[model samples]
Target chain A: MTDASNYSLLLDEIAAELDIPPSKYAQAVQRYTSVGEWLCGDDNSDCMDDPDVYPQGSFRLGTIVRPLKDGKESDYDIDLVFEIKKEKYATTSKEIKERVGTRLNNHGTYRRLLKPEGRRCWTLEYSETDDVGFHLDILPAIPKTPRTGAIHITHRSGNGTYEWSTSNPKGYAQWFEAKNITAFITLEKTQKNMLFESNRELFSSVDDVPNQLIKTPLQRTIQILKRHRDQRFANHPSHSSKPISMIITTLAAQLYSNETTTFEALKNIVFKLDAHANLQQHDFILEKSLADQKLILRTPDDKWIIPNPVAPEENFADRWHENNHERAKMFFQWVKWVREDLVDILAKRSVAQLTESIEPFFGERAVKMASSRLPFLTAPGIITLIPTNTPHIEITNPPKPWSK
Target chain B: MKEIVERHFQELVSEFKYLSLVHEEPEIFSIQGNIEFTSSYSEEIIHDSYNITIFIPSDYPNSPPCAQETGGRIHPSFHTHNEGTLCLASNIETVRIFDENRTLMHFVKALLIPYLHQHSYYEKYGKMPFGELSHGAKGIVEYYGEYFNTSNPIITLLLLKIIAEDNYRGHSICPCGSGKKIRICHGEKLLALKKLKPNSFFVYEYAECVFDGLESDSIPTELKSNYIYKKISNKNVWQHRSTTHSPTK
Candidate 1:
């Protein structure tokens, strides 16, 4: 057909390839559910009352893209919040963290799967097969008072000091869900039918498909942007300063206007972000009209602010002002790269030319997989042009003169 | 209107496969994405694509959708405005084509695709395969001249006056100076033009043609009225008159 369709189709294919496989999703659910049972099951006498384990972050949002490590697709990171129903004043942050770690160590399989404790979570690594696997990071927490779905999780600073950090993963998820509702409603039925058709052995009917499995355009847009970020920052000297997934997800969801396709969603989001980047390069003033709606903001002192929608106090860009605004600089630079690589390249290119241009940005494997599906490449030869016998549209009326 | 827009989007997505609904408002609905096409007559595989955004007004078939090139490949030097608004076809032709088939699909197939094809051909061959019109008021005069099949600007102006006033008289003499009655001469063409657009549209076009002809000294000074002359002297008219077609790239 045309370059517009070809470019978008290729991007869609790449995103589909990057998404977490069905088997892994099922395994992640089973593994985490068992962890929840062990923590609060009746068999364990030391079990706390009403402890719960549930997914958070990208897994909950359905925006998980296969992360990259050293230019190779790596394991999926499944984040779970193992929140215990207790007052924050009941115990110290150290106690809650140790309690969860000790409980996990109590299980034979978990003890074997467990890695060293992280800054905020206990990591459980699963074995890799066919170069694909996933790991679970269980963050030990207790509910924060007054606010629903807000929790105070344990954190260990670089100096090995333990403290409490407030997070509202559940509240954030609810907000994201609200933003995605419009597109979700439009695509849910069609997505369910397709899911059921593909997984006939697992699903009895379209109605049996889980709501969590149906991805809206917002989710797909986030996944695609995350992958672009991953590849853009891979092996860079300032890789640690790359824009985080939280910031990307928050901005994308906030700027989303219920666009019905990933390409449109992404183009609009980046177009606005590029505008902000251009402004940031100059005066960095907050326009009065855009002040309330701006996704990325700046303080009076020129510090970056990308506030968490659910937890207003928690700034997703907390580290953006550090190192002479290195994070902010890189974030804008990445936005520029995205505009050039993904959006601008779609203009005036053939399939082969597009493939070559995207290879360096999205990685060779992903590009190859995406290009392999193109019908143009699959067709035998150039001889397969529109047959002469086929009826073609004719311009019966004379051509008209055009003006501005 | 919403149902119609939704159906149009679905049909577009089914064919283009990449275009997605980008915006939906009470007054406007927009779809943005890439479209791929191959040259019909080319023996070799010549694939090309463009990124476009189409804005369909709520009035829809009554007021045709506007398409813009978002790819940054086309410049104003091509048949587009500086802001990338494509000069797809002359206003009258757009109206006539839409009148024949009042569907977004027909608009894309008949006007949008061919316009894009012309660009592709021009970019490769350094000349527009389909000849182009001049810009601004000059283009309007040229379009009417060609439509009425006459080199004389006065005759074309007279024909437009009849359309603008809705004063077609079959018993009257033809404006072409052929010494024949209007019914047997340009009557069919005039009637067809009358159906394509409202009288106000023709009035604007008639005024535009007069303004251009007066500027070029083709029309006599006696024909210039105080109202027309005063409007033509305005800054907006000068701005419209200043537009010149860029040389072929």
Candidate 2:
């Protein structure tokens, strides 16, 4: 019975039927933003003067496919890169990659990611049918200060997590960027033509053209966001802690060599996400319904995917940042409640409370997905509050043992 | 709690305790709840013609409270409008600004009685409920309005929104150089394509959304904002005490 335009009737009815708490939605948004910020490297972007490059969207928005015939599944491959520009992170391409590998480890069941393997990096891909698949890719650039001929995105590895042969791939990407050129050349030992370029000119396949060269960071971000919303997510679970909003803001904040940022910049990005129109027009009203859970929309049989909804508060990431601890606590309190309820629901269906069990709810066709998760369970940069034996503050029944 | 609900709760707890490699549960922040509605009314109350359940987490200060409907009730809005998910904006907007330092007990109490009873149609045509608190407006309808569509296959539509949002919210940075908001910059176009091609699938979904968003020409150079470049950087916030210690320079 909302007085709003009723622009999305479907969303209204669903919310009426499900009736999730307001706090749950806020917490979900907060969690999504937290994951996104870490992935992108900045948790705030609402105050950005210009938000297009750093503008907002949802985790699912990261996965819209290209307009082409074959580019349906993976039009863009983007990962949440945290402190990626830090010298400590980029110190050695190998070290940066190894760190990413450790951060990305998820019980080791899906495709493996070798931070910056020889030519490409591999990570886990969740599949409803296949259960799991190998997602191998490489970043656009790597640490090349001292190393040459490093590695590419997709590198098969018998080596360690994200470990590449001593060869450096950063040299090539950097070389291409500096020269603003592209080339299709066999990777010395491999005969495969690895298209290298700063611009789109170097694409070899008719499909690889990137549609355009030097896509605005916003443009590039759009593709990344679209990917998360596409039908493929229904097909599998990437299970990343990285949320699309955070990643977009981070890229926007760091689009240039010297871009400095604040929380407002990130919030601007969230607003952009709210304006999207992939879902049924009626669903527009329920934009926040999608906030609570890490979602993937699947038809009854789990094949087709409806369009994704965007977050309305994308332009408001900074307002929350003024009080990070407070915001986190608020977000987590609701999530824990929801998690308890969801655990009950999943238990009835015989699903576990751990991540693996959370799938049925996300994958369900009646997919009104919200979760009550342990907030600090697997965040990339969040510091787990562990108390030492100093006894500085008396501890009465300490909380349950912390998550690993 | 009834046996079934308790069983369900136990099942969920079990999953949290056992998530494997593929499926992972969200991290739990804290657990606490209030009997505000139940204590005040001593029973479930229907406001705006919907039954609601209120629940809180253990980490009351660190986490926000949650309330959801337990009984099944079909909502009216599902028949119209294409934005299928619930439009729970104000409610989310309210609690989204929660401060752990502030006692949320009052805020939590507001959600059930006066909040739900007050001007109800916040999402409807031209009705604006004045205040930062959306105790009932958010959870009452917005949550499902987007995902549950009576006109189309529910799952297909949900998938589209999830994928699209995932793409937008999942990334660490925008691929585009402009600083404008992504939704205004490229959101409509991506969703438009998704609506246009329901059966169509993608290899990397967001990548496709962007390619199509850009190919369709929604991205304009003028869309870039002067504030964008500055916003994404990890710079100091105005009046933040952390500025003294952050020393980005």
Candidate 3:
């Protein structure tokens, strides 16, 4: 049997290679920082006073992987939340969205790259020389309270009014970060030192470290899963309601127990995720009078909830109830698929065989890149017998048809 | 062999947090533990349960241990017999299911737990959780029928009888209702069974159990005489064995 620890190391190496490089991540931070400055600049102060801008989604969680579209590596969606405060909570949702869009449009460089208004976010697409690029999805919002982490973001409803939608992206990120805090920080330091040693000009000190560059076991597990999901659903664009990154991150975090290796964490998380996806037969009810008692992955109040760890009121699966549980089904299917694939890949003894098996799920390009960077990627080491006075190479058995 | 059993015992302890090994010896293993059998609507803890005498036979795994409950409180009707021996599983069935990897832990979890669960369920619901398999010889026949994918008990008995005699006629019609020659249908299965229980004595022992009610002191010489066989009995042979020998209700 293959040591589970070894397979875990292999997965970590692969995830590290697939992750966005520190240089590219640093560039993203710089761009977002500039946008944050503009959002709070002297000219835009009237729209919202002292607005804050920060990343959300995989970017904030440090689980960003090279996105795939139709089997081709593509742009990463860097989610940024622009939050503001005002004395009166009277500003219409439309005004808040427009104010942020107008600020981006007013900027000379952003005007060319700014996309037409999305339902919630105003996107800015950045061009790149390689296949990989970036799409900055800047969302405008207001906090639920001055100190609380919850926020209400604006979304254009079908009734033609921008309504406030509850979200807690910061809270979710904090919960994810706390899952493997020590490992993440330790890796962050190691990554920074390595970056400094390699290129002293790029990073002068540890504080200059690219925080997003370090990958923890939990983060790597999520990255591998996200990549698998992207490649698996690449062809089914119309059926593109695959499990979202936040739900996956939340569920994986809930199942993670700070396993020392990425492989172990991924294996455990995949299995646990699949286990939860199974609808508990006992939880189902058949009586008509029990109509008010349906709790299929929901609270007793009948709200479909995979509760935000930091805020109980925020249900990440709120949309699932309305979508005929399509997202739930897709999420469970992906969980089972990932579990089976990981089990099959981890059972392979030969490195070449293991790489071959994982390529279908992680993509050939990513697997190849990971294999090249792996320390033991070379062929199995030769076993040399100790030299004797009269050494002889002896054949144990004649090669037969079956043996060949 | 000792190492294998010890390792499996350790695994059983770890896998089931509630279970613990109270005593261990060269030929006997006594496990005393409790488990929370939680179902949909309710959760109940079955406490102070122990199967004291698990007689590990010399030909273990091939022959499973006959576990007997230690406490006298459990009624004989609850999956156990008058001698307090628990019918955890059919030896033939468990061996076939687990094959070469039939370790003590696998047997305990797969078969022993179900037996215990049945008792606990009976205590709660006043009935067996599922239909109980008939005990002793009749149960063995029923089990083999399922294993052979046959529904008729008479066919099972006759097939074993033929295997016991080692007189499988290729020209004889298959007993599986397949309307095929015996050489093709069920031939492989019969050969496999023969390989497992090579001595004809074991097969005859099963045959004797199946036909024990037929005659008081007959060697059961002939099976070709269908007329004689039909005239011998026209009642529930199992019921006539003894009033004490009742089928699992």
Kindly give the stretch of ten consecutive residues in candidate 3 chain B with the minimal lDDT sum: B33-42
| Docking category of candidate 1 | incorrect
Error of 1 at A178 (Å): 1.0
Model 3 docking category:
incorrect
Q: Give the range where candidate 3 chain A is weakest over 10 consecutive residues by summed lDDT.
A: A395-404
The native-contact fractions of the candidates, in order shown, are: 0.43, 0.00, 0.00
Q: How accurate is candidate 1 locally (lDDT)?
A: 0.76
Q: DockQ, per-model, please? A: 0.22, 0.01, 0.02
Best by DockQ: 1
Against the true structure, what is each candidate's TM-score? 0.66, 0.20, 0.57
Chain B alone, model 3: TM-score?
Answer: 0.66
Ranked by TM-score from best down, the candidates are: 1, 3, 2
- Cα displacement (angstroms), candidate 3, residue A63, comes to 1.3
Top TM-score prediction, candidate number: 1
Comparison by DockQ, 1 against 2, better one: 1
